[model samples]
Structures are given as structure tokens and as C-alpha cells.
Target: MKALIVYASVHHQNTEKVAKVMAEELGADLVPIGQAQPSTLTAYDLIGFGSGVYGKKFHKTLIQFVEALPAVTGKRAFIFSTSGGGEIQTHAAPKKLLMNRGFSIVGDFSCKGWTTWGPLKLFGGTNKGRPNEEDLEEARVFARGLKEKYI
Candidate 1:
């Protein structure tokens, strides 16, 4: 029941915060998407992908990485995202993408985060101080459940 969390949280570390909380709860390895190697994907039983939503999707690089990932059928995976103004549906892209590649969509999670990037930055961002402590605790609780159910 090994687990790994690979994430890309560029702006303000919003997504990273959620990933870390979940990782600690699940006792999973945490790796930045930029530094993750293909071999890293093979080591885990349950792999979780996390990212901050950009225009209703996970980071382009994260999607590309999964697209290029070596074939492995029936592998379990979960998707999580931090967003300024979106919901769990924004996680659908990653879920669909992974499902297309033979990874089982075991679970998913989402939460709002303080985002001040792109055009939203000019307007002083949204969800200030979000993905806050309460939100992170929710993430931890969710991770615990995923561990019990999926791992």
C-alpha cells in the first residue's frame, strides 16, 4: 500500500500545501512534478497527482507528464487541485487524462486557494489566505479516507 504524491504548485505554494498535508497523513513520498522521474511512477501503488488549476485544468506540464508516462494498466491514481474559482470538476481533466492512460481513477479532491496570478493578479487575486488551515485539515481528512479505502 505504498503511495506517492507528485505535485506542481507554482503560485504561492497553494497546491503544495495541500499535497504536503495529504502526504504527511498518508505517509507518502512527496515529489515535485518538475523533479519526478519516470521510475518514480513505478514505485508506488497509489499515486496522487496534485496541482493548482490553471484555466480549469491542472498544470500543462503535469498533464504532459502523465501523457508521456509509460504504460501501466490498472494502476491506482487520485487527483487533487487548488483553485481560485473552480470546484472538483476542474479535476476532471486530470482524471480523464489518467483514465485514458490506464490509471484507475480511485479518488479526487479540491479546495480553494489564494491565487494572484495571470489576469486575476491584476485584480488583487481571489480567495485570499485560502487553502487555509481549515481547508488543509479537510484535505488531511480526505487523504486519510483515501488511504483507508484505496491504499
Candidate 2:
């Protein structure tokens, strides 16, 4: 199946690491949010939206990309994110946005990434060296599932 991953990873490139593994497993293209075109998304059978968690949500640019997209039916989408905590709530808003746009929700993934945002920087960092090998292996597994099930 044709696939693409459009993501934002400004702080530590954590989410980018995970996105790369998933993309390699699925043979999908990787496009940074700044370079993605909403008009061209329909070409893929699967599309992934991901970013590092910021203030409990996705990066503003990634959210805006989904918002700018015209509604469609039967488009397949998956959500992923990386954060110091890897909380489930981080995917909530983006999932809702994709559903509202009529994309069929497939699955989601999240993992801890090095984070030193805010006061954490004062204490070194959290989850340092994360999105580590194990997390990436899990992402590959997740992508394999999506391909086995949907592709």
C-alpha cells in the first residue's frame, strides 16, 4: 500500500526517530510538516500524523495541517507521538480531528522521548536516550501489524 508519514519533531527529533522506523517497515514516505501538502494526501492508502507532545497536544503546525485538509471519506489514518510521559491523552485531540475529517482511524502508537522542556531542563532531562532501541522495535512491530491488517 502507498503510505506517507507527515510529522513535526522540533525539540529533540524524538518523534522523527519513531516515524522513520515505522516508515521503513511500511515502506512509506516521510514528509516533515513544513513540507507536506494537504492537497496531495489523497494519493496514499495510509497516512500517519505524529509529533512530539507539547502542552498535552501535537505541535501546532501538524494540527493545522490536518485542519486545513478538506474532509474525505475512507481515508486511513494513524496517530503517533513521543513525550516525556507518553500519555494516551496526547493522541485524543488529533484522533478527533482526523475522525472529523472522515478518515478511518486505524491505530496509534506512543513512546517516551527525551524531554527537558520547562523546569525539567534544570534537572538535566527526562527519558534521556529514549525512543531508544526497544521503543523503535515496538514501532516496527506496530507498523507490521498495520500492514498485515490493512495493507
Candidate 3:
């Protein structure tokens, strides 16, 4: 099945790491949202959107991508997020946006990523080196489930 994994990341590249693993697992194409144009989303059976949580919401690029997506009705999709904190809303916002655009959300994934901002960096104790081995394994399992359930 043709699939696209689009993502936005700033600071650490944790979100992109997860996207790459998912793309490799599904044999899907990887599109960096920053470099993707509005019309570049039509050639896929499944589209996965992911982003790093910024101030409790997804990156602006991701929001814009969802806003500009053409009619995706009946298309399969999923959402994934990487954040320093484990708030589910970070994933929910994008999922809701895609759902409103008529895409079917098959699954979602989230994991803590290294944080080099604020007190976390000074404290030297955050989810660094992550979207780590466990997270990638989880992502692989999630992709396998998507393939099983939808493809």
C-alpha cells in the first residue's frame, strides 16, 4: 500500500526519527512537512501525520498541512506525536483536524522525546535519546497493526 508519513520537528529531531522508522516499516514515503507543498498529498492510500508538541499543540506546519489537504474522504490515516510531556491533546489536535477533513484515523502513537529547553536541559533529566529503541519498536508494532487492520 502506498503511504505517506509527514512530520514537523524543531530542536531535537526525535519526531523525524519516529517518522523514518514508520516509513521504513510500512515501505511508505517520507515527507518533511517543512519542505512539502500544499498539493503534495494526493498520491497515497494512507497518510500519517506527526509532529513535536510545541506549547501543547502541534507545530504550525502540521496544522497548515491538515488545513490544506484536499478532500481525503474514505482515505486511511493515523496520527503520532513526540513530546517531553505525555499530554494526549498534542496528538488529539491533529487527529481532530484530519478527521474533520474526512480521513479515517486507524491508530495513534505518542512517546516522550528529549527536551533541551527550559529547566529540563539544566536539570539534565529529560527523555533524551528517545523516541528511543522502545519507542521505535512501538512504532513498528503500530505500523504492523495498521497494515493488518487496513491494508
Cα RMSD for candidates in order: 1.6, 0.9, 1.4
Candidate 3 weakest ten by summed lDDT: 86-95
Q: Let me know the TM-score candidate 2 reaches against the reference structure.
A: 0.97
Error of 3 at 135 (Å): 1.2
Off by over 4 Å in 2: none
Q: Where does model 3 exceed 4 Å of error? A: none
Per-model C-alpha lDDT, please? 0.88, 0.93, 0.84
Q: What would the per-residue lDDT of candidate 3 be over residues 28-127, giving only the tens digit for each residue?
A: 8898987887566777788888899988888998898789877665689899988988556777777787888889888888888888878768777588
Query: Between which residue pairs do clashes occur in model 1?
Result: none
TM-score on alpha carbons, each prediction: 0.92, 0.97, 0.93
Error of 3 at 113 (Å): 0.3
TM-score of 3: 0.93
Candidate 2, after superposition: displacement of residue 12 in Å?
0.3
Please provide, for model 2 over 59-104, each residue's C-alpha lDDT reduced to its tens digit, 9 standing for 90 to 100.
9999999999999977899999999898768898989999998999
The better-scoring model by lDDT among 2 and 3 is: 2
TM-score of model 1 (CA atoms): 0.92
Cα lDDT, model 1, residue 65: 86
Question: lDDT tens string, model 1, 43-111?
Answer: 788999999988777898898888888878768998999988748987777787788878898888888
